[model samples]
Target: MIEKTRGIFLHAVKYSETSLIASIYTEHYGRQSFIINGVHGKNSTVRAAVFQPLYLLDLEIYYKAGREIHRIKNARITYPYSTIPFDIRKSTQVLFLAEVLYKCLREEETNIELFDFLYHSLTLLDLTEAGISNFHIWFLFKLTRFLGFSPSREDAERCNFFDLQTARFVSHEPLHSQFTDKHLTVLFTRLFTIDSSSIENLDYTQHERRLVLEKLLEFYHIHLGNLGEFKSLEVLKEVLK
Candidate 1:
């Protein structure tokens, strides 16, 4: 049977001389891998354009209960990007965030809310211009809420430090190295109150943003232990610099 669903392209790799393997996060089926054939053949009809990172696609696919890889019957872009592909800054951000999502989102079960959040957030990134530099930092914090390890804010008023390992605000610096100072704790509180309507207000210098990003990655490392050093991170840092 064929199923129609919405999906976001995560990554693709050359599988053979004439084919590619793609990982996509589908709204209905969760994370799935598919083989896209004839991508390298000159006369093939399947355009490679649909496989770009974070591309929104409408797909008709064949799925099975225990299969490691599936097949797609049809696919096309659902929302055309205005400038992500041509703009270096936007494209770099997309690539970095897509890599993060690829590493973190591995569920084989449906999560409509999570899917909706990602779809809207990516769309907003493509459309926003005022706070592009701070987009990824904002996205990183928002993503944690859905990942089930959002930082604790209840102690913010009384505490001046953020314990990364414990995911909560602390009155004193943690004994371990995995902690943030009071300044970052204050910024974390401000970030917690932001959403799409207010994301543009976030302003930070490159150095300050880099510090926050490093700390956020540390938080992720503590919670999601398998996330190795992200390959796109250094490139993103340099690009933003």
Candidate 2:
């Protein structure tokens, strides 16, 4: 049976001379892998271009439970990006975030809310101009809420440190190195209060932005032990610099 769903393209690798294995996160299902054939052919309906990082897609798939990889009957870009592919800053962030999502979003079941959050966020990333530097930092922090490890705001105003291991604001410095100092703790806590409407208002220098992102990734690594190092991290940092 074939089912239609919206999807976000995450990553893909060449499987053969003309075929590719792509990982996409679907709205109705979770993360799934599909073999796309004849992508290199002139008449291929689903071109390889549509599989670009974090591209929103409309898909018709042959889905079956217990299958390691499903089949895509049809796939096309849902919303063609206007700026991200053209702008290095925006494109680099998309590449880095796409890799992060591919690594951390391992759920094999439906999560409607999380799916919507991702879809809208990517759309916003392509459209928004102001505060582009802060977008990835905001996105990483917002992602924690859905991953079940959003930092605790308890005593946020009174805390001098953010304990990465515990995912909470601490009144004193943590014993371990996986924590934030008072300055970063204050910045991290502010993320919890920000929403899409106010995202443009949030500002940070390049250095400050990089520091927050590193701390955020550290927080994620502490919770998601297998996240590993990101190959795109250096490129993103270089582009943003």
Candidate 3:
């Protein structure tokens, strides 16, 4: 049966001379893989260009439970980005975030709230001009809420240390090394209150930004053991710098 849905293009690899296997996260079905046949052909309906990282798409798909892959009957870019592909800073961040989402978002069920959050966030990324440098840091922190481990802020005002393993603030430093020191904790906790509307006002020096990102990734790694090193990390850091 053909079903209509909105999707976010995550990653893809060439499966044949003229075909590609693409992973897309959909509004109704979560993450899914689709094979686009003859996408390299001149008359292909679904152009390969639409599969770019984090591109928002409208899709008509043949979905079946227990199948490893689904067929895209039709696909179109829902919102063509005006700036991300053209700007190196924005492009790098999109690539990095796409890679992270590819690894972290594994649920095979509908999450309307999560889907809306991503769709709007990417749209914002393409539109926003200020605070571009700190976008990824803010995104990573916000993602934790959907992943079920958003850090606890009940003690944020009174605590000086943030225990990554526990996902909360500690009055004293944690015994293990998976914790942020007082100074970094202050920077890390500030992300808890920051929203997309206020992201433009977020100002972080390069050093502070890098440290906070490292801590956020570390926190993710501690919770999601399968999320190893990111290949796009160095590139994103270089681009942002």
Candidate 4:
């Protein structure tokens, strides 16, 4: 049977001379893999341009439970990005965030709320002008809420240490090394209150931004199993600096 859904492209790799295997996260089915055939052929209906990372798509697919891979019957771009593909900084951010999503999200069941969050957030990133530098920070923090380990702020007022391993604040420094010092904890408190639309208000310096990004990755590592080092991190850091 064929079903229609909205999806976001995550990653793709060449499977044959004219075919590609693509991973897409969909609104009704979560993460799915599909083989797009004839992408390099002269008469291909589905162009390779529609499969870029984080691109929103409208799709008609053949889906079945227990199948290893599904086939796309039809696909079209739902929203064309105005600047994310053209601007170096925003496109780099898109790549980094796409890598993070590919690593951390692994569910087949539909999560409408999470899907909505991602769709709107990516749209916002494409539209925003002045706050692109801080967009990823807000995305990382907001994504935690969906992944079931958002940091608790109940102890924020008096706490001076952020325990990454435990996902909360502590009075004294953590005995283990998986924590931020008092200074970073203060910044973390401020970061938690910021949404994507208001990310500019955080106003972190380059040193501070790097520290926050490191801490955010640490927080993910502690909570998620087997999330290895990000290959895009080096490139993203170079681009940002």
TM-score for each candidate, following the candidate numbering = 0.96, 0.97, 0.98, 0.97
User: How would you encode candidate 2's per-residue C-alpha lDDT over 1-241 as one tens digit per residue?
Assistant: 8999999999999999999999999999999999999989898887888999999999999999889898898899999999999999999999999999999999989999999999999999888999888899999989999999998889898889888999888888878888999888777878877888788877977888888999999888889885888999999989887
Pairs in clash, predicted candidate 2: none
Best by lDDT: 3
| Candidate 1, pairs of clashing residues | none
Model 3 Cα lDDT, one tens digit per residue, 113-225: 99999999999999999998899999989889999998988899899999999998999977899899989988987887789998976788989999999989988888988
Q: Candidate 1 has what TM-score?
A: 0.96
Off by over 4 Å in 2: none
Q: Give the worst 10-residue stretch by lDDT in candidate 4.
A: 191-200
Model 1 C-alpha RMSD to native: 1.2
Q: Write the per-residue lDDT of candidate 1 for residues 62-138, one digit (tens) a residue.
A: 88868999988788999999988987888998999999999999898899999999999989988988888889999
**lDDT scores in order:** 0.89, 0.91, 0.92, 0.91
What value does the lDDT take at residue 83 in candidate 2? Answer: 99
Clashing pairs in 3: none
Better of 2 and 3 by lDDT: 3
Question: Judged by TM-score relative to the true structure, which candidate is superior, 3 or 4?
Answer: 3
Model 2 reaches what TM-score against the true structure?
0.97
